[model samples]
Target: MANPVELTILIEKIKAKTAVVGVIGLGYVGLPLAVEFCKAGFRCIGFDIDEKKVNLLKEGKSYIKHIDEARIKTSLPLFTPTSDFSRLTEADCIIICVPTPLGRHHEPDLSYVLNTTRTIAQYISKGKLVVLESTTYPGTTDEEMKPILEAGGSGGLRAGEDFYLAFSPEREDPNNKDFSTSTIPKVVGGLTPQCLLAAQTLYDYIVVRTIPVSSTKVAEATKLLENIYRAVNIALVNELKVLFDKMGIDIWEVIEAAKTKPFGYQPFYPGPGLGGHCIPIDPFYLEWKAREYEVSTKFINLAGEVNTSMPQYVIQKTIDALSENGKSIKGAKVLILGMSYKKDLDDTRESPSLKLFDILQKKGAVVDYNDPYLPEMPKTRKYSFKKTSVALTAENLSSYDCVLISTDHSAYDPVFIASNSRLVVDTRNLIKDSHKYKGKIIKA
Candidate 1:
């Protein structure tokens, strides 16, 4: 068990802003968090297994689009980025912000989280506070992480006694200008009361507000519930989109009207499909975990099925648009607008745009993409397109048989695209509903 004196000393360090904050896996979640701690007058150390990321950060460069390089350069004196794990002993607070992606069969792959915990246990000392910011299924922090960390450490150090442990899921919305890391309300849950207090005290200094829950399991479930709610709601709208289209009803106009009611409704817009790191993947983690307890997640599975079918639905729309002008899908020139999953961001993880590109290529269409954020197509596990981004100009747009609007990047001129393209299959409803481009627009 940890000595009470040791716990008190750690709390004093945190309150005084004298604690060294160590953040592991400095990607989307960790980089912003390290910056927030540094901005709050704490000396921060960032750890990542990627040598390229470490080297870049060492030179005071920012790789993420939303994070400013000036912030990283100015905070260099207080922040140190490295790949070494031996420095783990120096930090008073250590937070794990690694990725917990789904595997081939959509199972929760905890390799990154477990490997990082094992490494931390080797050098973790008594009275140190550890918090997990990675999203996963319930019981992960208590059941999986607690066991690995305890077995790897020595000196009979136990969680909540010899050391403190907590779970605080990351709620990072990339490219969102309104709410930042410091502005977003944080949720924290711990193994014990002391553990909760230690974790909450550390975050109170960084975020605007911190909400403490009952246990780590609740914290884990909280994140899953948030994403699952979005997934099911988005799936509901996506299914309605197809049905409304067949009934000769415009879903966008319907949404605009329904939102005016101002009661018993929260509007969620339909897209080509669900994108981003959270909505498309997080729900499946709960679905996979629920199976272990002999339970079924029918809503999650159905949402997955509905959202996954949107790419093909879009392809059929493209084919229909081409056929209207006496053009066949085979050997047709198609230009995909935007490649990133969301608007104004460079992240393309699990993007529906890539799936659309793959299906278009396999169906014998000549496909090209243009995104101001992404100048070149990145290589993924299933795709290795060496194609570079095409320029979005009147002359370039006129050459394609159909222009497909996948991602509604703000930089794209929807009016200009609709005017120049032979036909516009608007998946995002970017084109204005006016008579100028009446015949040219086809909403997917």
Candidate 2:
């Protein structure tokens, strides 16, 4: 049981907006969260190992595409961006929002999360609240984090007794115009009942709603379930897309028609493949953990296979479309549109667009890319491109043998692209209903 006196003091600080909230890993998730805490009247300190991100935040310059520079500038008064871990001592509440990426073998590589936890443990004190917002397996909080934290803290500082610990998964949808961090309902679970209450009170100041669950493991599982649901459904649709293509049925049209039902149907569109930080990677964490229980995650494994194969599927469609025009891929001039995973954002982690780009180039096709978000291709772990974004103009569009729409950004004018391009391989169905470019389009 937690000391009632200590819990009360922490709750009081959160209610009065006087808590110093320390947020770690200032990326897509952490940056917005830190901003929300500051906006909610709490003094926030953001920590990141990356010096460039810290400098940018300190200067009120936004590196992320969706996070506005003006918003960062306005929040600078209440938000302190730093790389120093020693400043953790000033915080009443600390939130870890680091990356939980997969390893080379598709296993959960928790190095980032674990390292962040170790640092927090070194400076953690009694009466302080610690929360993890990183996505991972169920056992991560209780099995991995709790032990490390307990060992690092002072003898008197006990979880749920002297101090508090919780897991609150981050639900950050980058570039989503409708729901900001404050509006998204937060899910929090703790090592104990008192830990849960303290975390709930802290989030109540920022988010519109706070859902308290049984334990930290449940909270971790909740995040995995949310992402796995997306991965499985996306795979289902991607598989359907292949079958529908052979039957000459437009999967996009079928989806629009199917979505009219007022019950039990949520539409998940088919894309080049799974992308982003969560959908492409989070499911695998559960899959790896399931092996410990001597069970198989068939759906997850199958989804991985089907979704992973989509880039190749799109490539084949491109080759077929080119062959129809009496052109071989060996000498074809191909232009890839959209480098980022989704539209209106600049994040490209696990983006299938890169895979498509690599495949196209390897097959002897001359490949170029144009993304308003990314002017030049950044070096990735598996692939590196010495290419700059091509100018999207009438002459430029007409110069390509095939224009492949990998990401359906809102900035693209479907009619203009279809009218200008010699052949369009639209994997995203961006130009699906356009009557003007119907003749030049091939729905991949």
Identify the candidate with maximal TM-score.
1
lDDT by residue for model 2 over 1-444, one digit each (tens)? 688998899899889988899999999999999999888889999999889999999999999999999989989999999999999999999999988888889999999989988999998888899999999998888889887888885755678888899999999999888998999999999999999989999999989999999999999999999999999999999999999989988899999999999999999999999899999999899999999999999989999999999999999999999998999999899999999999988988889999999999999999999999999998876789999999999999999999999999999999899889999999898996744664578887
Question: lDDT tens digits, residues 80-124, model 1?
Answer: 999998999889999999988878888888999999999999987
State residue 368's C-alpha deviation in candidate 2, in Å.
1.0
Q: Which portions of model 2 miss their true places by more than 4 Å?
A: 434-439
Best by lDDT: 2
List the candidate 1 regions with Cα displacement exceeding 4 Å: none
True-vs-predicted CA distance for residue 367, candidate 2, Å:
1.4
Which pairs in model 1 have colliding backbones?
2-161
